[model samples]
Target chain A: MDTQPFYVAALDGLFGSFPTDADSLWVMLIGSLVGASCALVGSFLILRRLSMLGDAISHAVLPGIVIAFLLTGSRNIFPMLIGAGALGLLTAFLTDSLHRYGKLQSDASIGVTFTWLFAVGVILISRFAGQVDLDTDCVLYGEIIFAPLDVLIIGDNEYGPRAVWMLGGVTLANLLFVVFGYKQLKVCAFDPELAASLGIKVSLWHYLLMGAVSMTTVGAFESVGAILVVAMLVVPPNIAYLLTDRLGLMIALAVFFGILSAVLGYWVAYWLDASVAGAMATVSGLLFVLVALFSPTHGVIARVVAQRRLGSSTIEFADSAPS
Target chain B: MNESSDLPPWLEFFTFSNVNVTFVFLGCVLLGMSTGVLGCFAFLRKRSLLGDALAHAALPGVCAAFLLTGTKNPLIILGGAMVSCWMGALSVELIVRYTRCKEDSALGMVLSVFFGVGIVLLTYIQRTGEAAQAGLDKFLFGQAAALVDRDVWTLGILSVLILVVVAIAYKEFKLFSFDPEFAAGIGLPVRLIEIILATLIVVAVGIGLQAVGVVLMAAMLVTPAAGARYWTERLGVMLVAAGSFGALSGGLGAYISYLSPKMPTGPWMVVAATILFVISFTFAPRRGVLPRVLRHFRFRRRTAEENVLRTLYLLGEPLGQWNDSFSTNELLQYRSMPTAQLAHTLNRLIHKALVKEPAQGRYALTDFGVTRAARVTRLHRLWELYLTRKLEIAPDHVHDDAEEIEHILTPELELRLEALLEHPDEDPHASRIPGRFVPGESGG
Candidate 1:
């Protein structure tokens, strides 16, 4: 009852007994960076209407990481990331191909591809669960608490967690892609066939966009796990879309919403003594719902209000018209 | 032979030996039957894959129910899944009706957003450290091996209830699904019928959720329908075929995983269903690829014969004088046509008796051919006038349409077309119209 207040929960996490300063700051920074990365990439992803692919790739990355560990016999970040990203790319391509060539609908093709792929990963993890340190059950439901333990050092000053660095690198790469190909991506997203007719090479752009999503998603997967990664990709961009019409403004709003969710989620989780990823996803979901229902121009409330106004205007016009 | 034959009797056997296997088999068969019936309507309505979105939407529902009731009782969890899935279906329909977004986007957005919420709730449960929460996460990916007897009872009873509803409302559901515009015109409750169909699918998916998980539940509803589509166009046949396919796949997937202990049942079930789809995709009776290809080839051959007659009629003497016989070299050289193409055309002409070889390199049309050739040419000229005169097409548009229409134009349709055009003697280009086939006129 005493911890019901928001400010009290924030203060507790800031100087909590359980997680020391290093741990608290690192988890928050890594979580926010991962949050921002998913938002930035997800901005274009949602625009391209590829959020489902984002979900599939993120979840499907588990077996890739597991397989990478088995081959390299090392638990380092670089190899595992490359392996996972490759798997993500494969899932994206396979899903797109199945829809395009195999004539399966988007959800069915994606559902068939990912569940089968993830099932493979889970089975492998369960099989070698003893030998393999990381398991898919942990992967599907992420464990952000252990993230702070995997720290990266930069000389005597020391640096943030490895997850923060990975997510930061991905965020930087995603930002560059967005900036460099903004116009092309926009044109392609709007009318793909027109983009093709205009010689924009839509297939090339699609693969490029999907590659960026897979890369950033795999990087974030190491931190929040697959399920939370999906929430990050979907919720923030959707909130940003609710806030603005312009792509630039939308990305900014998404990053803002995402970072805001990370901070609030960490505090809420600390007070409630629950999972950080769950809090972040729930907060993000709450933000999305609020925006969906209340954004001035596009929200559900705005729609209903506009309908009423139109109804009144029609009657007035009808009364004034000459019979 | 068949891959199933290669396996040992123990592995290839259909059902489980003990009560565990029997219950699961019976439950899956009933589940398959229910979904197949509902899926027929869904597919007919062209929203074949909405079931996938609803299946994932059930996740947050189950989790929310757990949070409120503090129980993992099958009924409670099923209730939770049903509520959310129902909401998801509503949201999908609302988005499509309200927004300018295309159907795919509407489906994609609803699926992603609902699934995102489900993931959040699922992860929240795992992090809560509840003692009974061990198998709760399994709902996300489904684990058929864990399905006990009571679960089977719940699934079987629900399936029977749905089957009964489908049977009682068969006529209404069919008419509504196939042509709602007409059904509405006839005063049928199209909206209520659609709702019932959707509710049926939700119930079936909710039951399957325990065994297949969110990911595979969509396939359970769609793959069987897709596979069945190849075998028949009739609704009754399709429903039965899909149900059988679903049942067989579900049993095989469960039996495979049970025997191996390493593989999961859901994916294997999808594999079996996909295999059936592939079979149907290749070899279905009327619409199969092979039949389509053969039909296309035959049409092309027939079209070529008609074109040969039209060309002979245009180039030959007006009174059908030496039209049949033409030099092979001259034929190939006339339009820069390939020599092989000229040969193929000549061979077909000889086969059809329109043209013949009197001697080496000498060709002539029979009396039968010349009259037929003139009739075709007249049809072409008449169509040309009809296009330019009756249709008010430009002189340019008339020729392009007439060029193609002349060959396929049957005598009966041509007479009707000419009558409709009010009988013109000359085309827009001032070319003389050929005489019509009257009593005892040429080939008439």
Candidate 2:
């Protein structure tokens, strides 16, 4: 695999040329930052059985991004983040409200809410096609290859990539939120009933988690697009979940896997000269497949081997004892 | 095309003289109709996200087929899409069955993973620089303007096949959707039926990829059926409504994009479907948000009116005066109601001929009003007595419980309470339980 020209060229292009090539370095850094931020909140979402809600939020935040662009009349990250974050929470609220009050099923409401919002976003993009230089294709799959070009500038000083700063701030905020609210989030995720019995406001923690997810999603959306954000949010954390039983360990493992995917995914995309976000998503999925099939305690192979051992030992015991 | 641009967009769209417009419009409508019918089954079975997963999953198949066959043939490409989409569904089932991952996690995983793989393949194709790859990217968001005679024919045949299959296996599909366990218990082949249904969904999703694209196709599948659900409870009616709503959105989407150059047809179709969903969710009769809210307000109003009438009867009970006029202030003292509310209730009661505002602000019960108010007070006091005696509730704690039950108790329950309490003469408060006859019968 290492001898292949595609592989060697990709490795050299991203790593051997690393010090000189700020483009590959920034794309990799930004991807890892986004991946790690998403994985932090995604762990709780998986524990709470709300993985699809993450997918829904990622799509539903589009209109908020579009509307922010429309209002601010520029691709300002702060306004887009605020706008999309608010809409993300609204998506969660509306989905829950429709389920609780409208008597619509939860899955159907999620489907309805996100798709509607995404449609509105797409329509807005087309309506203002001339006014805004927003590309629909970029929004769908993303072009992480161009992430370095959107550099942050501050008063005669070029501070790195804008996506890096945006994603880094979100990652820090997520870290603080998870650290401070760990106990409540754990209780709420594992058992809302018990959390309520203990006098914890389950809904407050639920919304807090939702807000964190929305904020993370908006920050990540620029580089990875919407759907691939789901891949980052769900796949890495899920792989970690299969590997560990403890909550703290799971969160740690998920972040590790997320960053690992970002690093490896960059190479894969460089090799294929394709979508870096898509490559990252594909790599994370492959990692999950590997873990699901080979995890020591819960893997399919372990279970199969255990069952086979039990079967053979029982047969031997029967033959020796007699009959 | 230049000459038609002079006419109103709506008029031109409806004219159907432009062959291209007619093909795209008809193609989208058929796609919508098929997806709508399939969406009902998916929605009922709680597999709405499966459609999303399948739609995203079909991407790799489309690209894979284009690479393998090196042709732009619609049938072959769609065939590849159907196969891979089916595999995606199978993988989700396998993951859930084999692993500890919940259904939603499995769905989210499969949906994004397959889409990622598809993106990789799509890029791989684009980088190869083949001339055929020019329009292949259209499958991502869909390009309805690309529909030709052949594409329309393919969509028509697929739509008809979907309609026929659903119609022929209506009972089986219905039973499988509402209660698959029972369908199996009754000796129906539930697994086979499930496969057939999955196949139907794959076909519906496959046909829609070229029109709504993969990302927005879930809306075409979900919004129409969800909207239709608000309009009816019966399965048959829901299917028809969903199909019509779907077709309407599809046609509207095509027309809007036609009117405005560069407007993508797929998202517009979704926007149109979402509008229908919002309308149905908020305004549909009986099950709609407005109707339910209206019913609640009306109930509250009725309860307020009855409470006022009960107060009027109770005020006159000790005085032994059924026709005596009382000021709004007096009624408020007895009932603890607002002065304005009392006046409003009095007006409504007068309108019903139950009360007469004989003076500027004073009111009195008519003969009919006395009878009506007596029934309300009797139910209230009767409930109090029953709660105290039968339920062993404290005599002092029965008023609040009785207040709520009085407004809700039916006539048959009133008689049952009468028999249960042996027709008590006095409530726990020692107030007279007004008799049903004239005031002289038992109050004093």
Candidate 3:
């Protein structure tokens, strides 16, 4: 009864049975949204040399989310957002202060602050497991496969999965922030002293950027988990950084890389029956490796080839000069 | 409730009568010591997060080891972790050296990518429907309770082997950490020493994976060394102290986990290490916050008193009457200090017999105070003249520098400045430079 061609069926199988239904589509949509938003904010992080801060904020937000859950007895979005933003700011503040006043090195300060907060988060989750819905394993890798089950119901009308709506909102907010504060963010990332001299509140912009990272992280938490959020927050931007020089192009390319990773990662997970978030992160990482090795301007191969070419040309010039 | 009810009495827990507890405790101790020692070098080299990347990168290796052997043997899995993490470290080094990416970006890339691969492999393994795969999940956050005696023995031996390597290459590692270029210039095989050090760290991290897990193991490596740094300045002492702190925290974590069935050993151990860090950060004798703050306050108080004395001496300079006692109001005219603060400074000086109230609301310098004021004013003027004459600094810009330097300059520094400035009799402002205080001098 099937009228489809053999190549189409084979392609479908190759894409892990493509022509995906509503559930798979929602999963991919959410993955792309998470990837895009993280990449949008991550471009600034990479430029600012604060890529590791993204990792720190993602891990440190755990206790804030759990405390918000325990207090409200619900996974309401607003409270969780506020809690995560506050904790992200706290992580930045603590790391800065420890480096400045405690006479500790920058990496050591970051390592101490995030690890302590994360440990507390783990302990709180385990101690209050009976009272809250989160568990250690879910906190680590997440359970994005079951995301579609929690649909949003509004006045007897059933919408799609709640993650799509939340992630969409986060993506839109991130886009708006980037669009409006693009110049200020660029100035601050390239040179904070210049931004300050230009009357921009550098610390305020830093916190605002951190707030965006926190919001993106919290929105992606349920679907991808904390560690994978870190991956999305840094990997795409890293890849884009290697491929281009212009900030605008870098942002655009990072989003493209992020979406590519999400789509490919979803299919990889579907085919291999592995964690979807994990596969996405792996894909993003692979893309980074590819760019690092083969990008036209910044790639390792190109640099080596250029060096060799220059060496041979210099030798030829010397050979001719002897005549 | 069932788990807690099954636990032995509190005394039995402390006594370590259980063989499982004994093995776990010993294993954690060794893990702590090796990580602490190796972490010192990592921290000194500014490669703290490299340990983190290595730890995250080890997860895939662990899963690969499990898949290849179809076994959960700690030794076998750890060996796999070591190989993969070493590769990850090498990759990071290459990326930083050969590409435009900085160390931080390279580290973030390797850490997340390798961890993602591990997570993927782990998920696949979890779905394989094998009973032996049950314990493999423990490596994510660590399950010290699940470690057997054989696992303990393996970890202990590997940890000791790492320590021995560190001890054998101590001086070379020290040189490599402090100044790699100098070591290389001296023909010390700097690259080999660095590779050896990196391998030792990988081994230390590899053995610790079973007790602290891949996620939190960096804390074990970094926290103990950071804490130990607060207590000692010598590398030898720091190494010993860091090892002890590591062992104590490890043992304490094991004991606490035994007491509370719900508490996982890894996080508890981290909590313990953090507590020690907090203690060292706050209460250590020299580098701690408390002592530093106290010393700062003491210096501030001293500076205030000396400023008041100098102000009184300057107020009498126009009249050329060093012995005349000046009222607080007259003294206030020369300095912009608050009335309340002036009174407090005068009170402290009176207690020290540096100044006295010859009349109500009037202050006068004592014989000893005259010499002290002369010394302070001499140093201030000497620095001002030095700055203007030698450094070609503007007169207006030299006062602020002299104000701070006057309080901190040692006697030897004053002699050097005096010689350098050829014992100038006047400052850049044309004010007479007071001579160095002589104890037997009159009130001239």
- Residue A133 in candidate 3, Cα distance off native in Å: 5.1
Put the candidates in lDDT order, highest first: 2, 3, 1
Per-residue CA lDDT of model 3 for B1-444, tens digit only, reads 124445556667666667788899888888888888888898888777778889889989989999999988767887899999998989888888887877778878888888889889989998876778886767756778788888798889988998898899889988888999999999999878978888888887787777777657888888888888899888888888888888888887788777787787778878888899889988899898889999999999889888988887787677766667998878878888888888998999999999988888888998788789878888898889998999999999999999888899999998899888887778999988887765222321
lDDT string, candidate 1, B105-218, tens digits: 445556655765665666667767767776775676677777789888888899999989988998888788778899999999887887787788888888888877765677
lDDT of 2 by residue, B1-444 (tens): 748367777787788888888999999998888888889999997778888889888988989999999998878888999999999888887788777777778889999889888888898998889878887767656778887898889888989899999999999999989988899999999878978888888888888888777768888888899999999989999999999999999998899889886898988888899899889999999999989999999888888889888777777776778777888888888888777777777788899999887888778899999888888888889988888888889998999988898889899998888888887788988888877566565452
Cα lDDT tens digits for candidate 3, A23-111: 87888888888889999999998777666777777778778889988999997767866787788889988887777778988778878
Error of 1 at B241 (Å): 3.8
Q: How many times do residue backbones clash in model 1? A: 4
Q: TM-score per candidate, in order?
A: 0.79, 0.88, 0.91
DockQ, 0 to 1 scale, candidate 2? 0.56
lDDT of 3: 0.84
Cα lDDT, model 3, residue B393: 100
TM-score of chain A of each: 0.88, 0.88, 0.90
> Which ranges of candidate 1 are over 4 A from the true structure?
A1-51, A56-177, A192-219, A246-248, A309-323, B1-19, B41-50, B59-129, B171-199, B229-238, B255-262, B285-380, B403-412, B421-444
The DockQ values of the predictions, listed in order, are 0.26, 0.56, 0.59
Is candidate 2 or 3 superior in DockQ? 3
